[model samples]
Target chain A: MASLIAWRLVAAPHPASLEDYPRPPAPAALRLTTLGDPRAGALFWMLWLQTFDDQAGVTASFKKMDFAHLTAWLERILALDPGSEYPLLMATRVYGAVLDPGRQRLMIDFVGRAFRDAPERRWQWQALAAVQARHGLGDRQLALTLVEELEQRVPARQLPFWVRGLHVIILREGNEIEAAKRLMELMARDGGLTERQRQAVEMWRERLEELR
Target chain B: MHHSRQHRGQAPSRLSAVAILAVLTLRMALRERLARAMALMIALCWAATWFLASLLVSDETGPQAAMLGFLLRLGSVFLTIVTVTFSLTRDLQNRGLEMMLALPYPRGVIWLGKGVGFSLIASLLAILDVLALLPLAPPGQALLWGVAINAELWLMATLAMLLSLALRQAPLALTMTVALYLLGRSMHSLLLIARQSAEIAAEHWSAVVAQQLLTVISWLLPDLERFTVTDWLLHHGGSLTALAPILTETALYLALLIAVGHLELRRRAF
Candidate 1:
């Protein structure tokens, strides 16, 4: 229990960053049912891992973890509670196994549905997908598509104002300026913008014209 | 130099009387024959949990942490029941309850004071458990758990008192209280599970009857599950979204239990 608390304190600050060790294999031997509370189901997995770690130590057990186990565990957790954000977020962080594109794309697709369901979470996850598409997989087209989707999702109020005009922010970080401009226009029309936001939008439009 | 001046010359109001009762109840818990034994048992249980945790070969603490949490909650529930039942039964068996009723305070106030006192003892005990596990729980969650356990105990204490008043025997009252508690906690989950097979529910008249009975019982009973956010301690991000509603519901239920218990007490011949 003490160790778990320590891990949570450590994990909260660094989103998606886990300790450098392999994750344990899925507990396929345990005949579990999602018919009860999903939280309880997730707990079963946690306990299963802890049992493995007891003798080997946590680092050793986590080191034994493979990508397949992580993906499978997450998929099951999501199935049990699709709206549960923990599994999706935890899995999203680790899907890219050091620039290998295949697993990352598969995870992005898996989490995309959950991200869409959770509107507030859309920006961060879409940004992640965009990064995985661009640098990790070298699929610029898929990266561009994710950025466009992110642009549609972001409320103008949330994005920092002048930053996008001078430099592209989260959604358009890959120099997808045109998509950012279109999203800005939509926010401006939506019309709850602060004075700073409106000015930022006008400046961004001017900057867009100059760049074009 | 009047003794009344210590309390500002006011006749001890119902609140003061209740306060005295509560303090006395706490003292009574300590003085009870089982108090030391129970404390020792709890100590043994915690040591066992720690030992069991050590036995698990995994380095990841999540699994053992979960087990500890489950055991903590289950132990608390049992402890609350035992403490409430024992305290109330002793009071009834001895002449102490009659003495309290003989005092100038309203009968309802006496009942309320006893209930509050029982809950206070349970809360203190639960807090001790929390402190034992405090290093394991996160900053906000330990306090959240304290709130949850208090609410659950308050409800259970109210139930125990009600049963004690309605049935004079300790064993019978305790048996009924446990039955009611289990029914309260499981009723909703059972209904949800049964409803999944609507065709089965429809085909079997007995199933529909049981479902309806469960629905009624749940509506009347405290849902103990609402107070269990044990995972929030483990960074599961559980919300206290229903906190206000749960508090409101508990107050209403306690009020209802007191009214019925008071009426039952009144009907008894001295």
Candidate 2:
């Protein structure tokens, strides 16, 4: 199964590029390193995959990685092949971190393509929702719709603390602080507060009180 | 190992650990000039807090701000360095840790007992400092909240000790702890940089690597900034509603640090 996945990743055609994509120039050292390496192709793919893994596990797992290092890895992977599954996943996760609307839109389009190819994957849906929300796309109606669908399909018992927390954020961002507070209180009562979740709830509560 | 179920006399093992910790603290209080140094530093910090508070006047910022500002400026670095250095270098230097390990009690107990003892002493100093700044602080819950924030500082001190044990080098452990402190404080900024860089230079290998490393560092370090409620308490005259969560997370982080320290310490041949 792993081999098949690897093969599919390697054999997959390059993903279509967004027009006027603002690709930052590659670092001189990285470009030089890749140019001389015989196995640069495979190295690039692996680096791309590692970047996605880092993002996936960022909150609770990848605590030792610094921002500069993560960016460098993503850039290196993308430099080798922009269309790889690894870079696509990394772009989706990175969207939440970026503030620029244009950059976020590019990531969203990439995610949209990934979803079209793999419609059944829930993560792609979640990524698209996040990117769309960040970009203020479609009156945010589409993002809300995706979240609503996700909430229904993701059983309360099975949902990760972060995913659940994201729903609370959605509520608060939508000016539903009271509802968000209530939801956070419920989560705390149910012992669902991961360290980060608890901190987020506290921050949200403080904001709500300040507004009040 | 003798297992004494009933104490016909004093429990020597327990008494011994307590005695050791007391002696250690006393010696530290004396040798490192901790007594006189801490006293002077605390007084200076209190004066600074007073000055800052006077400038704010009747503003909500008073007790918590004074306490937290003083601690961050003075207590955190001082207490952390002292605790971590004593826990790591002093023990190995004097071979005191080896003797303690030879005792009947579990090594974990000894490590924790020492941490608790150091934390208690640090907390006492912190309380005194906060009390000194009370005159400049706003009335109401500020003092109470200030004490709570001090407790968080002591908790971090205990955590530093565990890291000292794990790393087994005073300087390196102190460096790492401080680095973690900085990382936790600048988490939002770090995340921003990672995301922005990734988007702008998606094709740049170096940028990608940089972002990945930042993510890892963010996850590994305990976010000390979250416990910094003194500002809110002082400036806004408000208490954190997330006290329960904060306490829970601190406990988990402390436990994990101690557990990892124990594993590392146990593997040493000496």
True contacts kept of each: 0.05, 0.00
DockQ of 2: 0.01
The top-ranked prediction according to lDDT is 1
Which candidate comes out best when scored by TM-score?
1
lDDT tens digits, residue span A1-212, model 2: 99999998889565543222124334433433332221223233343334343332233223232334444455555444333344555556543335555445555555554445444444544645563664555335545555555656555555567666676767767787787788778777877567877787788788877865
Instruction: TM-score each candidate.
Output: 0.57, 0.48
lDDT of 1 by residue, B1-270 (tens): 255556677557889888988888878877875467556756766776677667544444444444455566667667777777777777788978998888877787787788778878778767766675666666466666667767777788778888887787888988898888766766545666555444556658777676677678778877666665555655446556756767887788878887888898888865
* DockQ of every candidate: 0.06, 0.01
Cα lDDT tens digits for candidate 2, B102-135: 8777777777667666766666666665565555
iRMSD of prediction 1: 6.6
Task: Indicate the residue-level lDDT of B44 in model 2.
Answer: 70
Q: Which candidate is the best by DockQ?
A: 1
Q: Which regions of candidate 1 fall more than 4 Å away from where they truly are?
A: A1-212, B1-11, B33-38, B41-45, B51-65, B201-205, B239-242
Tell me the fnat of candidate 1: 0.05
lDDT of 1 by residue, A1-212 (tens): 99999998877453332343245333321212322234545655533533433342233333344546556666655554444454555545544534455567767776666567665655566666666676777777776666556556666556444323322443455566787687677767877778877887787678767766
